[model samples]
Target: MDISDCKLLKVTMDFSKLNEWRTLPCPKCEIQLDIVLACGQSFRWTQLHPGIWCGVFAKKLWLLKQNEDEVMYQVFGGKTTDSTAELIDYLQLDVNLNDLYKKWAKDDSIFSKMVDNKFHGIRVLRQDPVENLFSFICSSNNNIERISSMVEELCVHYGEQIETFGEKTFYAFPTVKALASVGVEAKLRELKFGYRAGYISRTAEYINSQEEGEKWLYNLRMEPYDIAREKLQKLTGVGAKVADCVCLMSLDKPGAIPVDTHVQQIACRDYLPSLKDKKSLTPKCYDEIATHFRNLWGEYAGWAQAVLFAAELQRPKVKNLVCLPQGRKSTKMEEIAKVSEPKTKIKRKKIK
Candidate 1:
């Protein structure tokens, strides 16, 4: 349909140190696209088809300016435009440059460099809570490419489409009203949500009928960030790590730190030497391990943890987080493609 018929709302949020955070009219739906946890990677939404218009394709974001409260932003194309001038323009799309970065640069040191490296062209694009929850539920023991495929398949199968720019279709990350209102079992199978589909369905059914806010796990961004975190861990499929992720990205508890296996490995190796010799660890230990950094990195702790993990994974020594290769090490991308390879080969041979 016609997007011109709708009014758009834009809100800018500067997530302390992680990166730029903003939401604007989806070029398609004219609705707010809630992309959060501002960062450089957006494989969550764009992996299926490069440049594909689905009303949403998480783009790279940059900070135009940062005042005492907010940071203006723009999203750059990626590894290609890694310069200041280009990065600045990408963020100043509709704002003025008031030397905000320069002021922050006055205290130039390691932190400034960290901000320069991580903050420039970074954005936490908001996402639909239900979608983020489901997407993340599928995250445990999962890879990026697989996560992308699973989420996309869910949209294609169960989500409604928003007709936008040339073939642009967007799905509203199926709600309880949507999933419970429909055939969840078959939909889960179709999307390949895997074993957790039942748990996901259970969670949705429980929450959909309640007054549970989008911030239910986040406690409406009102409670002390820690308490909000406590509430998140109460959900199934959500351990200390998953809950922290939802809190950081959805609940605005920017301080929330998630410790998945990768982060756990890093913690024991670098920070938590005391926990090293001990065989059995508890959630309290994970919290203790993550909390130290949360304080160290300030509000950017979650982002820092993610960066540390991403950097470590690139080291070539780390194994897969969710799925490993049959005989060799595999990046998340390799693993996802591998999942469908045998089927693809049989189809190709049959056609030949």
Candidate 2:
């Protein structure tokens, strides 16, 4: 389970031979695969190349790419059934994103000014509740890169291997049973999970003790947002913010806004000048901020929060193009050139 040995295996594999690539009518205004995949919503997706992303979701390995109007995808491993409906549900393409953008712009003046093509198509991902719950548990006071590494370690150690491409392998997220087994905390500590080790182990055991086990977590989707949030907080290591994240990302509650220090700053600086003097976010302050955004952005407030978060983090810029000129044909060299190239200024020798 030494994950460092897992090199980039897909770089050499032929993508076309696994399955026929299909297209879904996904415009950039509706879905920007580059931004949506890399944003903090999910940690599994890797941008194998510019405008092309690879990830495992919905129990399948996916190689996905997009243009201005459509998304192209190829599938490998898992069930061989049609994934069109699954993809739509995961992406939530049924929702009118363009309409939401217009509504958000109309409601907040700062948002109106900040809304640009770069941040467009940013949305909350509908992820697996079990996976989402554990992932965010690993997120407390941690950076995204470390969180991703921890998640992968969880998979590599306990989850079933999904597929093997030459020397490297891909794994699905571990099941509650796998994580709840004996000595999970000790094993996790050995892997350097720190104090969060106890949290994850106890939480898994708690879930497994439920009448229906993991199904109970899925059933949270049907409960009221308040009820779901309250229930999730009952587990070990889960607090208000973690519960809110589960509610927003997976439990079908678009209005559940998870407020962290970053969000607190955004609210005080851009929208609520009155709250600026408060030194820290108390329970009353947290509710005040969440309630304000819920009222301001309406039901899809979580989605709106994602856009602001991306801006606050100052996510790196990526090249976006609909298509090449009518007569200009794309070449392999051009594609390779698009990858980030290091820029350095050299002091040229003065011609004496």
Candidate 3:
């Protein structure tokens, strides 16, 4: 299927005339809503039921379910004449991902094997820039579960309430002004945000103070990848990895490859076998890895990286454990036992 040959049209319709449960065909590849939502990209969506996930987007609350041939969805709180169009755009449904898979596979055989029959429906989301920026900033040195918790806390503390659905309530992602008006750092610290509290607070203040405000962030989509990344790096907590994430996910930079630990490991183990000897990835090595993938996957390198990253997450690994043999303990065993202990009591420094 040549995606370029197909005329991709946005879905537009009057939602009021339609039934509460409507289905949208997904013939190219099955829309794996679970994988797409859980793949460490956007972090706000929650599973309300089996195959049913709910989230707030564009200041509207929505519930969606996926089946074999179609996606079923409905808008809950807000009225939009073209909810289907919005959903199509949000999912990037018009873009043929199977075509992309074929292209990526043709370029790298290793990628072909790595992505073979796994994560077929994983797509990089076109997330809102402001929301994505703050979200990734909270992602530094954080796991997905903790990051989701922080984002939810931010919305609950500063965002506007949309409506209540059963026992769960949805809140709009807070505006820069709204986030800045509250003592953001103090409030976030109180919510156990740790050092990231300062980053989110300062970045929100910086964005709010800009003459163009959110528009300034959105305009990066028009800039070249490097220039946009440089501008994003200027934000308080944003580094190269975080900047690349926002660029790829929000700023319309499809070629931007975020080289994190998982990505670096993938490059060393699969793409660049010569790099296997290197224990730590220096800045030079990081750029080499990023450049390698960008050149290999072409314009949609970020999307390729995303699929590989999700694959890496799904791969199983053996955990090292220490066992004692009937009260006989050696120094080696003692050291391994210490290593096996989980750091659950670690304390975080408070922001002043």
The candidate scoring highest on lDDT is 2
> Against the unseen true structure, what C-alpha lDDT does each candidate score?
0.45, 0.78, 0.73
Q: Counting only residues 3 or more apart in sequence or on different chains, how many pairs clash (N, Cα, C under 3 Å) in candidate 2?
A: 0
Better of 1 and 3 by TM-score: 3
Off by over 4 Å in 3: 1-19, 28-30, 79-81, 315-352
Pairs of residues clashing in candidate 2:
none
Q: Once superposed on the true structure, which residue ranges of model 1 sit more than 4 Å away at CA?
A: 1-43, 47-125, 164-168, 212-219, 278-281, 315-352
**What tens digits encode model 3's per-residue C-alpha lDDT throughout 1-352?**
0001111111222223223455677742635787777667787775544455667887787777766776767677665567777777777776667778888888899878887565788788888888899988888877666787788888888888886665456788888877767678988988999899999988888988999986888999999999999998899999889999999988889889988888988999988998889888788888999999988898888988988987887832212122223444344322221112122221222211
Residue-wise C-alpha lDDT for candidate 1, range 117-147, written one tens digit per residue: 3233222333444566667777777655566
Q: Each model's TM-score, in the order given?
A: 0.57, 0.86, 0.82
Q: Go through the candidates in order and give the C-alpha RMSD of each one to the true structure.
A: 17.0, 11.4, 16.1
Clashes of each: 16, 0, 0
| Local distance difference test, candidate 3 | 0.73
Winner on TM-score between 2 and 3 is 2
Candidate order, TM-score descending: 2, 3, 1
